[model samples]
Target: MSLAVGAVSSSKNMGFDESKDSEEKSHVSESSKNLPPPSPTPTEEALREGEKYNRQMSETSLYATEEEEDDEERKIELGPQCTLKEQLEKDKDDESLRRWKEQLLGSVDLNSVGETLEPDVKILSLSILSPDRPELLLRIPEAGNPKGLWFTLKEGSRYSLKFSFKVSNNIVSGLKYTNTVWKTGVKVDSTKEMLGTFSPQAEPYTHEMPEETTPSGIFARGSYSAKTKFVDDDNQSYLSINYTFDIKKDWPSTS
Candidate 1:
C-alpha cells in the first residue's frame, strides 16, 4: 500500500483509454490481524523507555490493523502518542536531523503543527477507468456526498479505481480503504486495501487499485448501493461515503 509513491498525471475528469478494453476490479483485500504491541508510530513516536525500548520493531505488523467494528480484539497502544511539533523539536542542532525533518514535514505551517495530534486525511476525487470507453470521475464534497446516485459502469467491463487525497496534521500509518457493494440487500463485493504509511507533505497522494471487471448479462445491469471509508491504524476514520450507481449493458452516452 502507500501506493501514492508515484505522482499520477492530473486531469479534471477520468480519462478513457480509447484503446483495447482491459482491467478488472481493483481491491487490496485485508485479512483481519491482531495489532501486537506497538512499533514506533513513525516520526510521531510514542510510549515508555522500558518494555517499549525492548519491544521488537516488527511488533507493528506489516499488515494494516483491521477495523475495530468487525474485530473483537481491543487496541493496546501504538505507543505513547505525541504531536507533530513534539517530534520535530527533539533534535534541533544536527544539520542532518534538520534536513530530514524538513523532508518529512514538507511545507507544513509551523504554527499549526500543534493544532492536531492525529493525522488528517482528505479524500478528494475518485477515478473510474474502463478501457475504450469514457471514464468517470466522482468529486467528493468536503462533507461527503453519501446520498442518491453517483455514477454508472458498463456491465462486464474491465475497470480500475483510483483515488487522490491530501494528508495533514501528522503522519498516517496503516491507512486503509474499504468498500462494500450491495445489490437488492445482498452483499456482492467487498474490498479492503491497506495503503501503507505516509508522511505529511504539501502535495496530495494518488493511489490506484487493481483492475476489476463487472458481472455481465441481464442480471448484472442494475442499480447498486455502496459504502466507502478511509481509516487509519489507530481506528481514526477520516471520511465515509455512501452512494449508488447503475451498470448498463453498454456505456452511457458521453455526448
Candidate 2:
C-alpha cells in the first residue's frame, strides 16, 4: 500500500497541477497587495463638468467687472456743467478783466447806459502777462466814453476789490456820455477768480469777482473808466472802455 501511494504522488499530473495552482494563487495575492492606487480617469462627463464650472466662474467675474465699469461711466457722464460762476469759483486767483460772457448770455443794461441799450458783447482777444502773478489784456470795443467814469471798489475787510458804476442819459441825468467801463480785477495773486453770477435762481446777470489775493504789492495802480453816449431816458446808448496797464514789475523770465 505504501509503495502504491508513493507512486501516485510522484505522478506528473498531480504534482505539476498542484504546483501551478499554488503559484497562481500566490502571485494573485502578492500582486493584489502591492498594486498601485487607481488612476484618475479623464471621463467625458467629468471633463464636461469641470469645463462648465470654469466657464461659469469666468463669466461671473467678467460680468461683475463690467457692471463696475458701467457705473463709473455713468458717474462721469452726469457731472456739473462749466458755467462762468464755476470757472470763477475754481480759478479764484485769475484777475485779467471784467468778462461780459455772463451778461451777454441774456440782454441787460450794461453800465446803465442810455435807454435800455443791449449791445452785443463778446469776449475778444485775451492776453495774460505777469511777473509773480498773471495780468490780463482785454480788448472791449463797444463800451461808450470811458474817461471820468470812476469805478468804486466795494469797501470791506475782505481782500477783494470791486468796481461798479452806472451810465444814464446825458440829457436826462446831466451825466457825461461815459461809454466804456474799466476796472482792475481782484489782485493778480489772488487764489480766487471772479464769479459771474451768484444767484442761480435768477437769470445770469452780472458777474462778481471773488477775493483771493497774495500780498505781493503788485497792486493795480492804473486809471480805468468807461466812455459813453446816451440817446434818451429809455432808449439807446453806446459805450467804449479804456484802462491803463500799470504794474511795477519786470516781465516774467519763463511762463
Clashes of each: 12, 38
lDDT at residue 128 of model 1 (Cα atoms)? 92
Q: What is the C-alpha local distance difference test score of candidate 1?
A: 0.77
What lDDT tens digits, residue by residue, belong to model 1 across residues 70-154? 4632353578777887878778888899899888667777675565788889887888987857668877876756557788788
Off by over 4 Å in 2: 1-142, 152-202, 213-240, 244-255
lDDT of 1 at 44: 31
TM-score, every prediction: 0.65, 0.18
Error at 100, model 2, angstroms: 26
Highest TM-score among the candidates is held by which one? 1
Estimate, for each residue in 94-156, the C-alpha lDDT of model 2 and write its tens digit: 443324433423332323333322222222333333233334343444444223423222111
How far out, in Å, is residue 189 in model 1? 1.2
Each candidate: RMSD: 31.2, 23.6
In TM-score terms, candidate 2 sits at 0.18
